[model samples]
Target: MKKLKLIAVLVLFPLGLNLVGVWELQRSTDDHAEYAAYQADLAEFRPELQAIADNSGSRPVMVDVGDGEKMEVKMALSRVTEMQDELDTLLPLTNVMAWVAKGTITLGLLAALVGGLGLLALNWAGRRAMHSRDQLLHSFTRVTKLLPYVLVGHVVVMGAAIAAIVAFEALGAWHAGRLSAGEMKFMFFGMVLVAGCLYSIWQMGTQLRVMLNMFQPTPMDVMGEAVTVEQAPVLWAYVKDLALTLGALPPDHIVLGMAAGFYVTSGDIALAPANTTLTGRTLHVPLAYLGILDEAETTAVIGHELGHFAGADTEFSMRFVPIYHGIERSLVVIGQTLVDSEWLQRATLHPAFMLGAYFMESFDHAVMHWSRVRELEADAAGAQLAGNLAAASALVRISAIDPMLQERLVAHITQATRPTSEHVPVSDLPTTVLREIAALPLTLPEEEMATQLPHPSDTHPSNGERVASLKVSIDDAVRSGTRPLDATQACAAMDRYFAQPDVLRARLTDDYLSHHVQQDAVLVETLRTHAGNVTGDVALHEGARLRGQILIGFSGLLAVAGLILLLAPVLFPGAAGRDPQPFFVGAGIALFIMLCMLPFGVRLFRRAHKTALLLTPDHFVFANLKAPLPIRDIADFNLQVGNVVMLTILLEDNAPLPELTSRSFFAPDVALNKKKRWLMLPMSKFCRDDKKLKLPELAELIGNYVNAGAARHLLQQRSEQSGELKAG
Candidate 1:
């Protein structure tokens, strides 16, 4: 449907140009008074020429003329005859040119009208089809399916129209005895237009075929290694049983990927109920996702993928995929063609191109909006299959885990590579890490969740929106009686039945490290040395101190200026009577603002002065801590790198601390509780320009004091890995 609309625009664009040409031609040819006056002059001279010719009497006769003594009558008659012939010949051609101009304008108007009506009808039909929902899948199927036909029709009609216009102009040039330079240019432009339209149509067809091929179900040949029933019988059994319970056909092939998601693929044609089977279906399950998800959650995730098939989403997508991709490819082709042509490049800044671009953008947005609706429908189906609560929980967990899992994997690899670790075999690493991550809270904050809202181009709704919709489904009586095996037991069963676990684990680890890790043996050694020398309080970096001083100076300057302003009226007594109130009011506001901000300014100054890493014999002090933290109580310390460096301290169990009030006078009423917490340190404030400390160095230093054996071993392993990398 969008393709047809674009084709209409293309046709109408040239039609408009041609109409303008015709109008200009008509204006130039409209005045025939000059030709009529020339005819009248010729008519007046003809009689005199006839009399002169008759009087010549077959000889060059001398005759008495008014202005001269003698003249040849034959020569005078010849001049009059030439003037009459020229007028007679030129006048008819002028009339013919005017008529042809009017005819071309008429043809252009007719084509525009027809094309506009066709496009309007197609758009109206599309809207009607979208609104009609009595037949579920059948409602919009016919309308959507008609889109390709309309596109083909549009191509044919527009191509023919362009060819006709070019032919008419060429024929007119031939009839006029020669083609003007401007006419030749117009013909060349017409040819280029035809060629571009043809190329775009061909490209759209190719893209559509490729997009449709994605829906053709087959075995998982190009995906990850296959997980047969023999290798994961229990896992397979749960998935198969869930499929049957949800009224969906079980997948014949299951493939495990390294990424964190699952999806289903099926053939384009829907099979009859009697012949329906899973022979042509493939289910792709990412091992990372499976490892982290509990049995129920896993069921929910798989159910969501299966829902694509059970909910007729696969069929709907087949129709929508072509339209969406066709618009995208067409835009690319048009944009590229315009850029490649100098004339077209200039034309892009014209209002026509801007309007066209806006139209295409609006079409894309509409298609994506429908795509998001399809996603929600599929989610609802999955809710029915796996129970709404489970489905909602699965989505939320996936949203959080998708980003966190990679970091966790990197941390685990760092820990497992340590020399002091009882090297758990690679086969055991995935399960161990999964269990550890599962134990941590996986809630995403509301602000972070808001970022997931669907953009104009996105096909999926936000996680929060999906969860809300699932909750509605749950409240509306969507539930399941069947419960899967316990999470721990299910994981154990999967591990026991799985084949080549070590190879898979190593593959995932290597893939991650290759992309993310950059080995630096020298940097590792430097960090190790820094860890050994951290025995005293470290001051803020010189850069941080300079920044702090600048801020303090600005604040002090403002304060001084406010005081001066407050005393300005008294000092300048000549102006006191006229504007004393205004001066006092303005000065008072400035002073009040400065005074209000004084506490914050004092806090910033204190942080600049007192912020440090205090490493004592028995404790580690960070940032603005009232006292040092006992080294023995620290469980782990990690670093997060961004605009500024942050060191997070995780305490063991639930350690207690003394009650404290806010350090800043502005917030004196705020209080702190005595409990183990994740404390963050702004390490950038304590860094120095001459000897800048990296996050890894800081983390290593703190880790050494917190867990000496683990820190030493981890650093040693890091050194070894770095050396190996450098050697290779």
Candidate 2:
């Protein structure tokens, strides 16, 4: 399906280019036909005029006026020769038009040919990558290398086609201008095409920059503390022995952290604690996981990580990871580019974006399959180190418990961040939390565990598939209860591995608490700001002010131009050559434009001067409306966040809303919709200083006010009912 879409885009772009050529040709053909008819009519009278002139020297010829009336017209033989010469010169213009049309059409055909051949080459490479399973690494490497060139080729071809079309169209327009005195109109269109071409170039440059940034060596965020060999000699020894047993290269750096899973990487890592970067191969041990898995299962997990370092997989990864990241980043940038572009720019850029996307998509598909295969091989290597049952058991335990553990951790953090929640003191907080999580019985159902697919990050296969490949039954591998290490054994292992386990755990806990404390502070601050906004005026975003200024300036320019156009021919009639029709037409257009634009500019200026949104105890007011909307009339308000943040206000049914025609710079973006009105402003745009504000925080604040209003209304109704009952 993806390939077909790609092909369709490729084919459609060239066809669209050809259509441009056809339109140009048709326009020129019409002009040529008109001229040809005029020239033929003139040719028929030439011989009679020549005969009259030769017989009578410089005689005035009698010509027919309208309705069979005769009129005398002066003529000379030299004047007749001059008129014929002018016609002779103009006749060759049609030939130039024909050549221009042919050239444009030829360019389109060439573009189509280039696009077709590029697709073929990519298809052929993809087939080789898919079928060459025996030489999988070689095949994947070849495809990876080929992909960049193919992508570049597609972009270049599309760019060249656009450039060519723009050139040919501009030439055609310039010629058309000679026939009709409308050069400015044609020039404006030409500028638009040129702008589109330039914007496409900018988009390509942005993608290239994103791709290039990937190659710059940057520290990978490990989000954990580093563990040196001196600090955890036993852990390091265990990893080295596991690597030796698997016949793989051992990691140079080790990190013990509270992340959900264990992993290994060849990239440089920046440890969360101590703010230090570690270079070369690194192995990360999730501290929480060690408490859950017994010694043998732990060994099996380590062995599996070592497997990635074995044979050709390590070499493949060294080459593949950078390309993978580059492609991912470029795709994200292009997608954002498309979103930010206007409709005309989108039309010009969509094809080029699609071609690049197709290449990335194809590469990802091939590499993902290869990754899955490599993971299976790693599982086999792990089984050799420990028994197949141990390997299978570790896989099942990790798959089932990791998700629940992550959820528990998030719940704990959420609890700690609440305003009213108090901190609990513990001697070793990290270890205590891990033990508690480990003691919780695994509730993951067998069916669900069997269905869990590989995470894209590591490409680890599902528990069911791994166990089946190892010839182990699901029942045998699944943990019956919390079969984790005893607390005493767990403490012993920690002591044996980490050098000062208690202090490290304490520091990690402090870091976690401190992070949550900052979050609580932010929440408090948002509440304070919301309280202020409820009582005070909320001003328009700076963008609104800028928009108002732009509108005013534009309107002023239009007015000046209109005045000039209207008075030009009137002030100097001789400039019009005694035919004032062109000047009249231009003045009429200018007058119409000024009439439309000036009023809109005034409205924007008035709105921009007023407050954008006014929040009060009882009512909400907008800049555009004279009357305020009572709080009771509003059902709800929400923040729709995307490329921009929009506050949508949903009104109660049949609520009285002011009728609006013109769009105000400071008013709601969509006021015509009866159900929902919105302020199309990003939160950041509201502040002069670049303060980062969250959507959910503002949403919550608004909800609080609305809910408070509802509570008051309910109490009032109850009081009224009580009074009525007493009276009865």
Candidate 3:
């Protein structure tokens, strides 16, 4: 059915293009004939007038005008010649139009033929696959292998055709002597086409370089800078043995880096010097994963990555990489080039270009679809090497652990910054955080997990789909008596392998801090001071209050305008003019606007009015709260910073509190159950200027009362640091 539909499209699309060409040619031809007749009439009329003027008795000729009126007029031969000259110049354009029309028809038909052949080939491949299960698999695999080449071919052909059409049009315009400098400059669109071709060539060149680079031996010094593998000989040996057991060439280099996943890159040993074998590769294991997964799970990850090498899937996949990138680059370049240039923008909006753009996008979607399939096939191969259960478990574990690790790392940073008597050694941080994360109940719910299906643009299958595939692979592996390696020992080996754990921890911590922290020391000091304050309700920032008032005032004006409009006609009859209908319509629209604005205006008024925080010596009262939150019951204070500063108040118990009618526009504070209590307060509501009272300060201030010991310790540390600076 799909094949038939494709065939129909191939047959009709080009024919439709040809029809447009035919219509344009006919119209231009008719217009040319009309202009030629008008020129002929003027030529004959001029001669007659000249003849009449030549005769002395016919000094003034009385010509019969249209509607049977006779008009006396003196004929000028020069004026007649001028009119004929204008038509003579326009006649060449008609010829050019006719030539363009013919070119279009020819190109359209040629495109149709090529499209038909391609569709027929696809149909043949599909039918051949359907003959048997083995043939079907072969056919599917072959299509995946050839699809990129086919798509690239299509792009080249289409791009050439478009360039030709544009070139022809430009030539026709130039021949007609109607091409302007500005029009000639639109030839930049052709340059854009050339640029796309160059980009594709560049992409292929880069791919070749990458492919060659993959085989070359990685320098020990470069590897040493980013990853540490010298300490974990056992883990390294195990991974090597696993590769050998899986019937794959072992990677020469195995390094632990900071990325959160594992992967293998293959190089051809044949390209290397005489001492090296033709199969050289590198395996990169993320330090983050090492701390999170157990030994068996880690082995499973290694197996999965090695599985790609075992099947040569990694090399095969690289073949399509250039093709994919080329298509993407071409689309971006062409679209942007056309859209950016004024003349080209109008020119490229032609049907041919529009159709070509659509085809390019469709081709991209198809390639991505195949890319996802390749990922699933790789997953299956990994399962075969690692055992289905182990592979699937590792896949699930990684997805769940990664996000939790990030959250815990941030918390760890927050905790470590406090001036504690017992300092947390930097070397122990990664291990400590990982252990804590492992203890948390962080599994994603089944329903939520199911929704992680692959998007159209995704290159890999969803976690859920991958797990399912692994489950099926697991049954086959079990029957084959595949014995999975012990995960515990692998994890222990990784832990032992890092020569300078402190360096790794410091790097990761510094990276996290750089991205997440954004406040100066003065702001922190201000927050500390505020944290110690046991004042009455803190008012909303003056700026925030004023902004809220502005919104309220605007909404109020809208409401007043609507009310006046609604009452206008009734208060003064015919004041809206004789058309009562238009008046009523206007009033109705006004009333609707009022209805929408009034509620929003009231909300803004309340937000501005109730902008103060009420705090007693023992408790803190949020905006318009009837009761205060006891300081002793507060667990901790932290900040989630973005455009707005959100102060998260962690409480020890889930005590019900009165709901504030006014909600923060930024993001409402979440109230979870008691014991795991956390409430968010947008600091923009209280402090307008970040320079005066930043998010970090608010966190510190709240932290002091919530956890006074930590706050006091931080303050002491700050004081000592300041004193040292002063002394220096």
Candidate 4:
């Protein structure tokens, strides 16, 4: 709803510009009594000059005696002629200004009308298209293709408006007969707007290139080892039969990984760990879950994945995936790069780009709606392949069991990697997991069973929703466990399919654990180094101070520029000509802007002075802390890098903690949790010679003090894994 309101504002921005143009037109074209008198005198004096020129002898030429006073004909004629010359010069400039204003109003009206109506129609079409699969696919494809054109149109409209503004200023200076400081400043401003528009376009092009690159095939090594038909003949045979039964094409390739759930993809798969690529229709089956889910449950899960390949879903994906990634990249670029640009802000191009961005963003709700519908459709297909109850049971179990499995795996990895504990091989992880799954309660809690499954490829329906859609009770699904794992192999799927199930499990588990341990080692080292008392000037806060100073300088420049514009007409009377209203108005606006910005700049500057962060074994201190905050109460910390580099510190507030405040004008305090307080630390460059607190060092220090540094290790593992999509 907030996004909709923002889009409306953007769409109406051009109309607002039109209103300004209208006001300017009226102001420029207003009747001046002095100029009118000059015109009247010129009319009366022209014939008198002609008569005087025609006379053979010296004659006392009587001028217009409207006030009953006769003047010297030659002298009156000279004054009237001078006024006529001035009028000839000023009238053309005034006409040009009027024409420019009209043009601006016309263009602004068209842009506002077309942008608003077009987005509304598109939004309506998008909502209507959700009823049919083909329509849904077409709607998304059409919008994706139209996005580039919409952005281009935005640029063109903004460019034209800027051109109009520049033309008006240039012509105004030309009529003035000399360049004034005000004219030069406005011209410079117009140039900056053009530069910002061009830069923003270049950035969009760069992001588009990134989107195109995503289409190329990337490796699946990080996801898992590929399984050929020869290696898993039974599994291959089962999948082919399942695909045929579900009226879908079988996967071109199969990958076995230790991820939580199953998923299918037709796009290029990139492997994060190995930085490699794979191309083809791929089906990824979770190795850990294979031992946990029985035959019927496995059949239902596999059916659900294959259901995506049914009804031309994968075929649509071939077109949709690249566009989806492109939109994501574009939004990221707009938010992170273009949105923060000072040039764009000054030129007001930021609002234009945001308009385009939000138009694209508005489609997300529709996309999510249709995405959920697609999932539900696939769920129905899965139900058709297996019994509805069986499919429901599989969905419920997958959602419930995965978190439990992750907890066990993370716990084991955390303990095994500890400095005090002996190295423990994870070769028997499959057998251990199988035992744990068998030991799970016959019925899971409603909260756990009602949650959505963990799938990386798309948003999923909740377990209860899927079960209800399948016309089955949640309790029935929970109680309907799959048959036990084979006694010897400890996994039904492994027993039925692989010739060497134990060996494969051992290799995969060892590889997964080794990768995690290697990543954790670096974080563990950092934690150990920063586990003692430390004091240093926060680079984040220092960066904020520098930004504040820059802002102050910018505001000062604006104020100075405004003063110059306000005084330009007086200092250079000839350069201002007959009117000085434009200069005064421009000066007023600039001064107002300066006034508004100065306070924020000063606040940021003052608050960031001597800002230091102190970390100790027990607590940490930041800004003007009334008391040091307990390190043990530190819940988590996240470092965000972009236009503003910031570190967020979350502290548990259940117990009495220090009254902490940032007093930052830009990034204020945000409430993240009911019983927790959030502290924002703005950061930038750090001293690398172990002198100042680094962002990563700060996170590590907090992680070390919290939960015996186990979360620190877990955080590293999770960060890498979540950074890119895995098999799940």
Best by lDDT: 4
What lDDT would each prediction earn against the true structure?
Answer: 0.54, 0.63, 0.54, 0.65
Off by over 4 Å in 2: 1-5, 22-56, 61-103, 114-124, 132-184, 191-221, 267-280, 333-357, 363-368, 419-421, 425-427, 442-444, 451-456, 479-484, 512-728
Clash number for each model: 2, 0, 13, 6
lDDT of 1 at 509: 52
Predicted structure 1: lDDT: 0.54
Please state the error at residue 712 of candidate 4 in Å.
11
Candidate 4 residue lDDT tens string, 462-571: 76777788898766777774334343444655556877777777777776777777877887666555543334322223435665788799999999999999999999
Q: For model 2, name the residue pairs that clash.
A: none
- Clashing pairs for predicted structure model 1, backbone only: 217-266, 217-267
Residue-level lDDT of model 1, residues 561-599, one tens digit each, is 877777888898776767688777777777777776665
lDDT of 2 by residue, 402-486 (tens): 7776776665564455422234444465577667765766565767555653332455556678789989877878753225546
Those runs of model 3 whose alpha carbons end farther than 4 Å from true positions after fitting are 1-24, 41-82, 96-237, 252-259, 265-282, 288-298, 312-314, 317-407, 413-425, 434-492, 495-728
Which regions of candidate 1 are displaced past 4 Å? 1-48, 58-96, 118-126, 132-241, 249-255, 265-282, 311-314, 321-377, 406-441, 447-458, 461-465, 468-499, 504-728
Candidate 3 lDDT, tens digit per residue, 1-728? 54445544555666666676677667668877887888788877887866765673755666663488665545355556666776787777677767767766776677677666656655565556444434443544554455444433433344444444554444433323355777667655655665664455445443333222221223221121223246556666777788788876677666454423576554321211123333346666767677566566667777766765665454543333333343444445445555665553333232223333444443444445555566677667666665667667666666666666667665555444433445443444455565676456655544433444212123566766776777555333232222322344434544665555565566555554432333334557665775565443443331344555666677667767767776777887768776667766776786677677656555544454443444444566665444666665566777776766666677665546435544454322334334456666654444523124565666555554555434444566667864554454
Compare candidates 2 and 4 on lDDT and give the better one. 4
TM-score of each: 0.47, 0.63, 0.44, 0.66
| lDDT, residue 611, model 3 | 38
